[model samples]
Target chain A: MKPVTEAELHTYIDGALSEGARAEVEAWLVAHPEDAERLRAYAEQNALLRSLYNPVLDEPVPAALLAVRSHAWRRYFAAAAIFALGIGLGWLVRGMFITPQMLPASLPRLAATAHAVYSPEVRHPVEVTANEEEHLVGWLSKRLGTTLKAPKLAPLGYELVGGRLLSGPQGPVAQFMYQDARGQRLTLYVSRQRGEPRDTAFRFSQEDRVSVFYWVDGNFGYALSGEIKREQLLNVAGVVYKQLNP
Target chain B: MDRRLIIEHIPRLRRYARALVGDRYVADDLVQDTLERAWNKFYLWRPGSDLRAWLFTIMHNVFVNQARRRRYEIEQAMEEVPAVSVRATQSEQLELQDVDRVLRSLSPEQREVVLLVAVEQLTYEEVSGALDIPIGTVMSRLSRARERMRQLLGGQTVMPLKVVK
Candidate 1:
């Protein structure tokens, strides 16, 4: 048999050898048990790595990470148009353009709708639970195309209750839910805005059952919505904005 | 079908990312950025070509770029995962000591070569294209990584082989 090179040994360990090459290595291994042991060690390394991360294959893909058909391109163009028209003329202009019939999906309306739908759930409120804060933060940040922080509303008596990924009219949106002592829930809905960084001061909108305070800072549309009092929601929104921006 | 093709490879992309970054969140972030880049460059992907290899090539680029942006974070991640220690004596137990530590023990380039070859089971040619390194570099890195793993899992127990390259 030909002398087995180091590369060939590694090849046999990876099972990359041709039948003849594999047979030669097997024959050689019988004479060289040390080489066999080394080959076995390399095989074990592969097995260990495969077993360790193979679970990721079985993990249900995060909703934020799934193959979402880009449904919001229309809303994407609308939002871009909205921002383009205004030199920071902001969401009021957004409000005037959206007809009641079209409703066309403005930030606060979407935020409030998400809040109304999700906050009332007695169980299973979030897609990524708060305990997995790292994954939740990382997932939301990527989808929104910005580094997102689920603002610590702990000072305002609201604790992060986890978050979910929602497909909003304007691209992928992230809703982070926070709960107060009385079980009242609030959601901070975020959507990525197009174009350059432009600031839109806080815009307040009262939907059918939810009050929302939303604003656009740079490239993100943020709406803090809840069934809580206007003053209370606003206060929490202020805290959220400061924590996110600051 | 184009979209699903990208989605189909996400699991492997994620598993490789986890091995690369050493944290689930960071791993997902890597996968997300890879997916984002893949989408932006979707037109560049030739349909009939090895989609899996192309996706991995894109991920390799993303990982390299992100590593440049956050060199400090990668350094921190390179540390032995907290629970794994040299005290792990038995070869079997050592192999099981948080694959994170065993895998992260290799340098980034070395780890990439090993993972692509052993874990992903890509051909040496595929790894060369994916890492954009020469096939010779891939082979050398693979041997070095395997040798490191052998020592990492108590190679002292086995007699050393005669060939030293």
Candidate 2:
């Protein structure tokens, strides 16, 4: 027999009232058609609210708005690139940093490919020249922080033409070269403190037409790259790991 | 997983942020900062969770934190901030024209509950979590907001008081 309060009426309209409360409101509304008009206004507002915002879902998502697969990968790369640049710039400016490996992972791969391209020369091979192999090895050793050996490649059919000291995130890296009798060449890309092992196996990656086999262990990292088969590449990795780790 | 995936949600997040913050530039900045912070802290993101909600939660928190730090700035400019205009198609209905004004007239707390419940169509529980309020409080706020809207809209109401068997 009691009239429904405004609060109860609102809840009752929204279907939030308890079952008993709902039934009570229903019985009261039947006796009071005037209250029905009040309910209609709230319902109209709710309807209009839904109508106003619901179209947002139906709006066509602009192509530019999509998080494309490539975009995700680019973000991944950009993060890496920024991290690398930050570390590099920090080292360049302050010279005080946490660890050498804080240098970006991608930079070594670039260095490795560059090593592969320039290591072989009957004519013009190394920039610093290989006649000072010991100086090259010694200088890079002090910078990279482990003993350096230009790994031999006779089993893979190449001769140690020698090596060059190059700058890396860790400071200086050694690029050791070996050439076959027919003039085919392979480079043993060694960094004293290359990095913590990435996935801990020989990963053969190609940038352009050049193939690179890069691996890392507790002490150092090595990349032996050339135009080679997967098995041949892994075989190169095996030889480099043996000469470096052994 | 990727910053780009999070970027894809930027415009929607921006729109939502604009609605919530009532400033276009601030909303866009909130979205941009949300994206940047989300990118930095992404390693903490779980694989299976809802990224949109995650982004929204981050944006919501960032807005709250910024508001706290800049409370003086907010208070000084509070009265000067322009009122928001809701975009709705014009119709012959008397309610449509004033609905936007009526909705805006509600207190911010009440307006949030009404918009999230009625416009966003979120469940009471979800709105409670999103707004960080108790479910009971959510219901009360929602009921209060609806009642206020009803009063403003010429006291006309249409939702049924029917019992479901």
Candidate 3:
């Protein structure tokens, strides 16, 4: 039998050793009375530590800690509002000099707002489940007058949860929801709008904890929204863009 | 990063902070600062990584910075006032106060290792990652901490160290 080191003894006390190593340590401790006594003291110390601090877990989290989320949300919305105001001012100023076709559409902002409202839902997150993928695609395609395909995001650890039909300014919008193993949801919003067939570059925007990456491919506008980091959402956006465009 | 995902770790963060600082208000402040910093730098956090360990690392760094600042304040205050030894009461019973005193008797490094292992039940790997120390250092510090704790709690008077802020 390999001799148990002091670290192994500590690991035994922590209950982190493998079963075989734990058995070996226990056997060694039984043979050594002094080591057994020391282990007892360590166990008692662990109990005391838990007794002293574990109650903090049971205590209601102070309001200040809970306020962190709300504070972040407030900051996000404030920034988003400022950004929207800037865009609105820019459009107004630009409208004076250019035609309506030159003004960018507000579909991205709409998609972001829809994502913020619906992604956090515990229930009724989508109108149809992914199990009905064929029917869902057919229905959404007919409603939006485009061949709408739910992007396969399994490679990214996100599976299609479902989708819903939302009303857009131009026509119907199809929102396909995907969720990862961690229950984080991302929404892909697609709608056919009056735009020339030109591959527009991906534009990014954030609104109240939700990030959106939107672009136009021909007449269809697509936006991917999630509460993930920008780089991660961009990766997912790239995957969606390839699937839809290919 | 999702705010909700970060929010879910609040209770554990508070518990760890309280164990580190040994004061409710100070610990709460540390937790708040940690959360705020985490929010601001959420972009730096990698997805699909160990979020809890990452949060703990942030908390550890914040606590160390605050401790340094508070130590400076204490040094300035000590020059103005006589040095008073705040010794733990000689109580052998395993009461909560006795446990707290014994824990406070340890140096910050030892205390952190001990609390993270014994109280937070973090694995040695996790503690190493949280404290940014080598795993061997965590084990050695933890061993020393346990020995010191035994000596102190057994009614042996260890030398009074500087005040833990």
State the weakest 10-residue window (summed lDDT) of model 1 chain A: A96-105
Q: Write the per-residue lDDT of candidate 3 for residues B16-102, one digit (tens) a residue.
A: 888887668888999999998887777888977988889999998997898798873244334433323234454444355666766
| lDDT of the structure predicted as candidate 2 | 0.61
Clash pairs, model 3 backbone:
none
Clashes of each: 0, 10, 0
What is the C-alpha local distance difference test score of candidate 3?
A: 0.77
lDDT of 2 at A197: 42
Candidate 2 ranges with C-alpha deviation above 4 Å: A1-28, A31-38, A55-246, B2-15, B22-26, B43-52, B66-97, B156-165
TM-score of each: 0.56, 0.45, 0.55
> Candidate order by DockQ, highest to lowest?
3, 1, 2
Give candidate 3's error at residue A5 in angstroms: 1.2
2 against 3, candidate with superior DockQ: 3
Where is the poorest 10-residue window by lDDT in model 1 chain B?
B156-165
User: Over the stretch B119-141, how does candidate 1's per-residue lDDT look in tens digits?
Assistant: 78999999999889999999899
Model 3: per-residue Cα lDDT over A1-246, one tens digit each: 567899998998898889778778877876776777777778878877887788887776665665453345445544555576696765564445333132254876888888987888888999999999999999999999888899999999999999999998888999999999999999999977674564444556667788887777778888999988765776788778767766
Among all candidates shown, the one with the greatest TM-score = 1
